[model samples]
Target: MNNALEPSAVALGTAGWGGGWGVEPLDDGAWAEAERVASDALAAALEAGITTVDTADIYAHGRSEQTLGRLLAADSGLRERIRLQTKCGIMIGGSPLYGVDSAAAVESTRYHGGADHVRRAVTDSLERLHTDHVDTLIIHRPDPLTRPEETVEAYLELASAGSVGSLGLSNMGVAWVRRFDDALRAATGGEEGIACLQIELGLHHRGLVESAVLVNHPDSADRAVVGEAGGLAELCAERGIALQAWGSLGQGRYTRGTEQAADQDREAAAVVAEIAGRLEVSGEAVVLAWLLKLPWRIQPVVGTVNPDRLRAAAQAPVAADRMDSLDWYRLWTAARGAPLP
Candidate 1:
């Protein structure tokens, strides 16, 4: 059975590999070119020793998984070189379970976490991914209508069948995860449960850090409304859950020059550039390094399709080790654009 959760310091994200979210869908010719580019990026990532990859069923309307599948199929030894992870539960147009009206389904989106949807989604994801078992299966988002028991039932069944290796959750807060973990433990008799938690974390996106530091401030009340009441990194460490950060490079806002940047991003960019120069690394590495400095061994899912930038991100762990507490706070305070709370 493929039941292991061995993620590295960084995970290569394929969100932009096939391109289907908000952006216009590509034609066959363009898709072929995109896959070619993705192949090159994967090659570079492998060369850099980044063995974990993160993708989702809804990414590029399933094209991302399909592209990954084709690449792995083309190379017999490729599957063994990387730990593959994919997410389900988000239903959008182009999904096999999106009903018969394919064209109409593209105009809408929903979250489904029932037993049947979960099972079918992962099964179909396996088919698209061209793999018997995924190293990790994460629910893309929380389904408000579904019960924890229902998800646990599906997860156990999938794990037993070896269709999914490990379980994870994305875009979910600590309180909800605690409840879900409790039910998952009861279902598995405490043998298995959540192995990772994926959330938006980076220099520009510092809600996870601010969530704790702003506790007594007035912003804390506003944060509670959006489910950022505490530290996810702390919770993940306490529960032995791997904290995988998406948008770990701030989506290039800090590294991609400041000509069009907002005042806040511009300021953050200046600090990041200074730190990068001092460390003798790319700004991309400096941004990712900031997340690596956290107490938890947070794995940043670097999504850059550019091979050079991806390789730069691979250096973040080393740069992080070289960073001091003073510089770390410098970047944080610069990104926040204000004094420490």
Candidate 2:
């Protein structure tokens, strides 16, 4: 992996800045306030040695992109000092159903399209980002209807046109990545290939680890290709591709006590709390630190409208020695509420 793509300790997530995942709409004043907060957040991230900020065109209907662009435009120096990553793929319409919404509804509402949409989207994103090019551009998710090669062709064209620096895929199985990787290699005459693969990795989704070795059936094969647990980390180690982690906190479920697996959850939380209490930090910080300890270079995508939460996540201390192998298994088992077969 190139130093430019190596995983930083932290990566700022823009989901919360632009109304936050369909929870609420930001008014003009709120949007302006978000821009200020985002700018300050980016400044702090840069100062903390975190060089990446991840956003998407669909986020707040391009408000996140606009905000990020405005921040960069405000600080001419900071713009060049950071890595920018954004994804496209999932189409959103006013019907409230994403991707699964009807074509008529999609067309009638605000429908974000596929490759063509991506092209226009990137252009708009760049304009809003106030940058000529993006360091990393990711296909947010797989378009089942579109062939992988077709998608790669579009991304390659963007790269060739100097609109993007590197290409990546997200939420795809191994087969899709391999197929896309092959397509990109073939299309670019082997000059440029995929630089990274982004996926949901955390305690809840350990399926990737299991899927890595079970390549056979269609589902298993897909898992095998896409779910290579530490393969991304190991590959990044070899090629310098950074393994960026999304949903690092497991959607806040890790913090709550639940009945389905109350004992396990509580035990794990207690273990994390115990460590955090001793270290004088939040459980979220401890969770993030644990993620950093994995074999792959991890850049956590953290979402927070709260500045204090963001700071705590950015400053989370990694206990290099406190979490032992047994303790790790204990916590994992506690989280799962059952022994690994």
Candidate 3:
């Protein structure tokens, strides 16, 4: 990945900013407070050297991007320092997440990857982001109806027009990635393809790692993570694409939100706490460092909007540097809640 699109070891996720997902309805004053929080979080991210920020169009029904845009507009230098990434594909309709009431909101939300949808989505995203182009534009989800060729054509046009720097995929399988890349190569007759793949990965969810370790187990394939069916991590490494881990902090199950953790997860939290004590770092740092120990160089997207937490999580790389293999396995075994089969 070029410097323009290359992400830091840690990325900032904006899902919690500007009235993010699952948030209750907020009045105008409450929303203003949310924006203020978002601004502080962005400043914290920059201070911690987090170069990339991830968001989706459906996030806060565009408030997240609008908030980011306003921040970028206010500080001309901020736009030059940070790389912006946003996703499209899932079309949002009336939903309580956006403070809208509709009985069929779930039915109203659908995925579209047609040429028209891709073009319009990027164009609209650019307008909301207050940028002429995005550092990376990811497909938020797989669109069963649209052909891969249509999506690739749209992506190429956007890249050619200088509207998108790189392409990425999220919540997609290896087969889908191959189809898109194959179409891209056939059209361009070169090696250019996807630049990154984002998926949910953390101690709370070890399906990606389990898929590799449980080779002969009967339930191995069934339990495989959504994007790990065909060795997705190895594939991304071979193709020179970055593997980014969303939900990398495990929703604070092992850290701040232990009160709501299940019994099994509580056990894992204990193990994390042990490691954190030995290392003299916060539990959040240990959790993120565990991901950094992976050979694939997985980029953990820290979703917390709290500046203090973000600064703490940013120390994960340093923690990983000091963590030995035995310590890494100890945390893994606790999360698995059993010895390797």
Candidate 4:
């Protein structure tokens, strides 16, 4: 397939690759089955021309990372063709699971970003991913236990050792990013700060966009997703921090009807469908296209497991580029259930 857009435009997410976190595998057969499913999903992603895969160590309690490792090992040239991005610093089931002598029981997850934890986490992650260096290593979530300087120090150590090519931050605000960037420059004299920021952005989760729209209108408390002061998109644009949006599909609320579907979601779905029909594309394309047309090069992390849907997502750039500014705002306003002020 010909390259339509940049490989980073649509990143394949592997959180569901190793299978949902509900039932533990009973025996070797179950483990094999999970691996098969994970392998197939990744194969589907590749067939769709996605070269960026986003995964986390805590996903399926490390099974997700390990599966990717095995897949890379089997295929000699696949790793070189893709940009593998994985996240660290999220703790699950108490202490570190991988590299332990005993099996790790799947446990609830929470954030942990201590300097020691960060080092150990990246170490374990590299081992599981079967990679010398990941394309991008993200913090996953901010850890309150560690200060900004401590986080940068950990990142510096990893960068020096070639364990991670660069660092990214997930679910962080503009203030935290600026603070960390300043610390990074001061401590190491390195010009680079956070290279990317992964946050919730979609038809439903408009935290960054709403910050700008709802300025001076606090009463629109109903519309706040992350409650930023405003200008995150602008800041990210200025700093060249590529915004990778997770949940870019609104968790499938746009295509699939839900009981909790708000009025705006319904309206947005209608408009999206109309556009899709007019353009002869899938509704999924419409939703993803809307995000693609945003000002910045917002890479949407598509978690779809279906191969056909993955192919449709790859077609977003063509459909998205066709949308004019007027149509773009129509979808945005329909999602907000209010006209732009």
Which candidate comes out best when scored by TM-score?
A: 1
Model 1 quality (TM-score): 0.92
Per-residue error (Å), model 3, residue 79: 0.7
Pairs of residues at least 3 apart in sequence or in different chains that clash in candidate 2: 1-239, 1-240, 174-225, 174-226
Give Cα-based local distance difference scores for all models: 0.83, 0.67, 0.81, 0.77
In candidate 1, which residue ranges exceed 4 Å CA deviation? 1-5, 19-27, 93-97, 101-107, 222-227
What TM-scores do the predictions have?
0.92, 0.79, 0.91, 0.89
- Error (Å) of candidate 2 at residue 83 is 0.7
Candidate 4 lDDT: 0.77
Clashing pairs in 1: none
Q: By the lDDT metric, which is better: model 1 or model 3?
A: 1
Model 2 lDDT tens row, 214-271 = 4454655543434445255555455545667788766655555333325536667777
Q: Any residue pairs clashing in model 3, and if so which?
A: none
Q: Which prediction has more favorable TM-score, 1 or 2?
A: 1
lDDT of 3: 0.81
2 or 4, greater by lDDT: 4
> Per-residue lDDT for 1-341 in model 3, tens only?
22354578899999877766543566888778877999999888889888899988778877788778878777877777888889988877564432343345344787878898789878978887787888888998889998888888898899889898888888776788777767777778866888788889898777778878777786675665433454877777877778889999998988864566788788888878878888888888899999999988688988899999999898888889888999999899888878877
Candidate 4, 1-341: lDDT as tens digits: 11122446688988877656643543677668777887777787777778898999888777788888878888887777778888987766543454264234325556766787788878888888887778788988777667889988888898888777777888877787777667776886767767788888887777777776566676457665335526777887888889898898877777764344566578888888788888877777788888888888898998877777787777778779777878788888898787777
